[model samples]
Target: MMEPTAAVPADGSTARRIAPSRGPETARIARGTGKQWRLFNAALSHTPDFAYVFDLDGRFLYVNRALLELWRKPFAEAVGRDFFELGYPPELAARLQRQIAEVVATRGQVRDQTPFTDPDGTTRHYEYIFVPVLAEDGTVEAVAGSTRDITDRLRGEEELRTAAAALSRSNLELERFAAVASHDLQEPLRMVAGFLTLLEERCAGQLGADARSYIGRAMTGTTRMQALIANLLAYARLGEVGEAVAVDLGETFAAAIDNLTSRIAETRGTVTADALPTVRGDATRLLQLLQNLIGNALKFRAAMRPPVVHVSAERDGTGWVLAVRDNGIGIAPAHQERIFGAFQRAFTSGTYDGSGLGLAICKKIAESNGGWIRVASQEGTGTVFTVHLPALE
Candidate 1:
């Protein structure tokens, strides 16, 4: 056995052991890799969204499955056709051409929605992207774009809009009815108050002081209710009745002072304003806005002090922000948020006579003009009301 093992040294320089073979598996792997690439490319072409490739010079190189369906033309006819030169619907073609020109001019990505007419003559909406493609050398090689058909979404939106419009119309009719009804209710209440007042006058001394007080209370309640109704109607007609215009805060302050001239004289109140920026709003509302705030400032001054009202305006990023500050008995922190709400009043009717709606109306006016109002105050220090409105352009 030993002699057999050593007989020929097994040709040590040339002989080698057999290693495991990988031929079949390697061949299978190569086939699988090819299959994956082919499948990937196929899926890309057949994708549902409209995807396209264009050359650097703005020529169509490829279109995906959905685009073919949209164009309703065979790939053979569409392939290599000048995408921009090929006439789509006139409107669609014009828009697409404009957007393409813009993208090419800027060399930046562009996105927008456009409407296209399908072969069936139905309009379809698409949100599309036009993005630059880069080459291996880091240069822009071409543009690749994808478009999503948002026709159904647009249709649903339109339907919902129509429904909302109808509902709004109905609600407006109701609001009008309520306004009419408020006037109607006021007529009857006025008649009752007139009779009560006449009776009180006629029977003054014969009636006890308690009876007179009761009648006075009744009159006050009726007046407050009437005021509340009027305020509600005013709020309802805020934008509908008020015209949009440039309001000069300085001029508005003068008018507001005139309206409350008696109160200003009584309280010795002073209102000073800068050359406030002209803003977009209803002039009458602006006047009323100043009147309410200036009046409040005068009415709520710290005890035994002359009132001072300061109104100024400055340009913010998107608009003019106006501030009406006052040295008055400032509002409490807990009441800051509530004061702007409709029909909210901190002081009693004895201290202040109002429907508790002035600030709320001010807010409404600000919002209707695409802006808003805010407040900052501490009890007994001062109060400031800031109103923001779209500035006059």
Candidate 2:
């Protein structure tokens, strides 16, 4: 044992006690042992996961601090104890013994998931691995393993499965309802519009100016209603196209322009289109999508500028991106998202006359045809509508 001491002045005028000296062997041994134990504690006892070693006979050899704390058993009581004596369920103890035996026989590793209950009665899931520890003679000495808690991971997977099932059912019901309602409403609307036309033709001469004006307003209302119903039906039938075929988008663009020829002439709009790509989708629906987007550019023209729309296509990883750039009054940032929703219009109907279903229908059609749509706009500058579609090989 070393004794405590007080130092004297270097002049040797005061009394002093000499300090005891331990030999170099003692100092070296202390330094080596300190470093070894510190590393061992960090790698095993202080680790987050549960680590343990047991013989092929199922006797516990060592358990790390994490496992000891979980079991609420001290090393003195846990060491050398059989798996069952350590409070593991008999079935679990036997299953673990089998896995350890297999690892020893194969001289390899085995991994598995096991459910465990802590001393506090909280059940947890563990993903564990067993590795064989071999003796000097290559015989099975023990099995070493670690287990990570995975209860949260299993719970998340179960929740995702449940949500996916619910969403699938909701989509099916919505499709059925939209199809039936649209089909049923078409006939009655047609009859109302036909009778209104007949009344205007038959009673025009006999009616006063006010009555004639009222009839004209009624005709306009019916016309707008008919357009709404048509858009609704088209939206419902979007993804219902049976199978996609190779479609030349150049032809599709031409067809869309032809459908809107009168409107283009009325607005004095000029459409310049680049060479378009051939894509895989229903040509009729693709034509409709283009028609709506081009018509929108024409209708929403700036008051001072003649609408100049440019149509172009380019390849975008595994798909084609077609852009319809318009020199029109661009959409406001605040109203951009709402305009794509059914019956949602950004501008007042008085300023921009529409049923507000054009963009919504375009979105649905794009999605149904294995594509999607997006708009980039600035309030007073201009707007560009981009559509992404899968290209034909």
Candidate 3:
């Protein structure tokens, strides 16, 4: 019985059997994998970032074209050579070697910012990382590294810092001027109002009707001016005094209502509030913020109905959002943004008696206490003023 005999080994040992070749589809997949590796290698060579590999002893194992061009050396000269021997500054070379050693020791990656000098002798900033490459036995065999030029980014950041410093100084000067001017101007305004009152009383019978009317208008103008100065001073002084503390908004609401007791009674305004959260801010400023909003609601009532204002607070992200919604002559869309500026009035003084600094003051107070204020309203509908403030722990 003939059985196909196995071939004898040339070295007198058993011969190993061969497996059949893979199908054409398998070959195609293998070709695709090789193509991907070639594409990756091409990308590494062409990318702007410098890519390289270093052995355990900090000897260059593989250096991409980008790194070679930065060094102004050929790849043959770079491989097997240490970074310090390739024209890099000693300090920088030492720092990078230390980082590589740390990566090898911890078998982890290290990332940092480094400065390097160009061929033109100008220092450039770079953000780079050193990643450990491990062998199959789980030991770190090499360190792969990449560096991105961050010189432009660093320059931009420096410019921003400089601009911020200048802006801060300008704000401080403006605040000081407002405080000093407001204080000095009050005395002269008081004298004018007092003397005008005396003149009107002394010459009451002798003065004609037109003269009396003129004097009355002068009195009104002085009163309005005084109010404007007071509000400007208040706005400038926000966050200039008093440390922030845990303040119960419920108490603030009560105090605001108390401040507007006379107006509320005159207008028969009904102001209701929901349970409010305690926030971190100056109690005095918070009370003022509430008073301004409530006062506006009472003053700008929809003539068709008695003023109804609703105050409520809710949790919003890392802060508390308090809203004062009022049934009043709402603000037009065009004037909503401008109303927040100091002395920027959308309505005439004859219609609404205000210094136009209330919302501006509220904005400053909110920002100083780490918060912000915004308004949402439509003409003839209603107005909602929202203040977001950080809640107490």
Provide the TM-score for each candidate, comma-separated. 0.70, 0.64, 0.79
lDDT of 3: 0.83
Off by over 4 Å in 2: 1-37, 43-48, 53-62, 76-111, 117-122, 129-145, 180-187, 229-291, 302-306, 312-322, 332-338, 349-352, 361-374, 378-381, 386-393
For 1-393, candidate 1 gives per-residue lDDT tens digits of 001110001111111122343587755654554455445446666667887766655556666667777777765566555655666756666666666666666778989997777778888788999987766876676677899989899899999999989977886887897789889988988987898899898999799989999999999988888888888788777746367888877788888878898998998888788887778888887787778888888888988789999898888998988899998999988889899888787776477788888888988777767888999998888999998888789
Q: In order, what lDDT does every prediction score?
A: 0.76, 0.81, 0.83
- Indicate which candidate wins on TM-score: 3
| Per-candidate alpha-carbon RMSD to the true structure | 13.4, 10.5, 9.1
> Candidate 1: global Cα-lDDT?
0.76
lDDT of 2 by residue, 99-200 (tens): 888898898999999899887889999999999888999987788889999999999999999997886667666667776776677677778878878888
Give the C-alpha lDDT of model 2. 0.81
State the TM-score for model 3: 0.79
Ranking 1 against 3 by lDDT, winner: 3
Summarize candidate 3's per-residue lDDT along 1-393 as a digit string, tens digits. Answer: 112112111122211222332677755654554455455556677789988778898887666777778777765677777868877788888888898999999999999998888787778899999999999999998899999999999999999999988877787887899988998998899999999999999989899999999999999989999999998878876736467899999999998998899999999999999999999988888888889989988988888988999999999988999999998989989999988898887798497888989888888888878999999998887899999999897
